[model samples]
Target: MTADGTAPTEEVGGWLDKLGALLRTVGLVVAMGETSLIARNIREPEGATAAGRAMNPGLRQEVVCQPDATGVPWWFWVWQGPTRDAPGELEPLCPAANLEWAAERITRVLAMPEGPP
Candidate 1:
């Protein structure tokens, strides 16, 4: 339970389910992984940095959702770009109270040509 006496697991699952549905509507395929929900085609980098090249020849965009300390789940736009030493970078998007708001925010970000830092 969280500080507010809410079950974090249940809250997280609810939003994840909503996100899964929204992603399907947008034609973005989502797969349930061990820890996070993985979505494809949401990010694609034009060029590869040295760090990116070191890890892989081509970099792809992916959206991931992971639970955090707060009841609200953390959304991430993964592989936005390469960091100084890391092959890829993860940008924290936002934490929303409900799936609708989260889907809107995610859709807006996904529409952008450039991925977040």
Candidate 2:
């Protein structure tokens, strides 16, 4: 039980680990942090900006799994800028019930080519 008397929710690490492994097999690198997981294209050297851009034009993607005040575990992409009083630039890709589904969505987006199809 939590401090608010509600039952604890399942931790997200296991799901993240599974997703990370899946990404690794396809040549991407997953970096797990305390509060987030970042997946980057690993085909280029770390300092090779031109090569990196040529390989994967999009910036590294991030996923954050955390509970809101109500103890509902929400999964979403980490926004790259400061929060504003207005609506955020990006919306939640998945609901609180499933992180794996969200990860799959991220994978699909990452796999897309940089320009028009």
Question: Could you tell me how far off, in angstroms, the CA of residue 65 lies in candidate 1 after the best superposition?
Answer: 3.2
State the displacement of the C-alpha of residue 113, model 1, in Å, after optimal TM-score superposition.
9.8
lDDT, candidate 1, 1-117, per-residue tens: 466644466655666677878876875667654334665543436565778756653322455565446545676666644556665566776663456666666555455355546
- lDDT agreement of model 2 with the native: 0.63
Output the lDDT of residue 11, model 1.
59
For candidate 1, what is the lDDT?
Answer: 0.59
Residue-level lDDT for 14 in candidate 1 = 62
Q: Can you tell me which runs of candidate 2 are displaced by over 4 Å?
A: 4-10, 43-58, 82-90, 95-97, 112-117
lDDT of each: 0.59, 0.63
Candidate 2 weakest lDDT stretch, 10 residues: 5-14
Q: RMSD of model 2, in Å?
A: 5.7
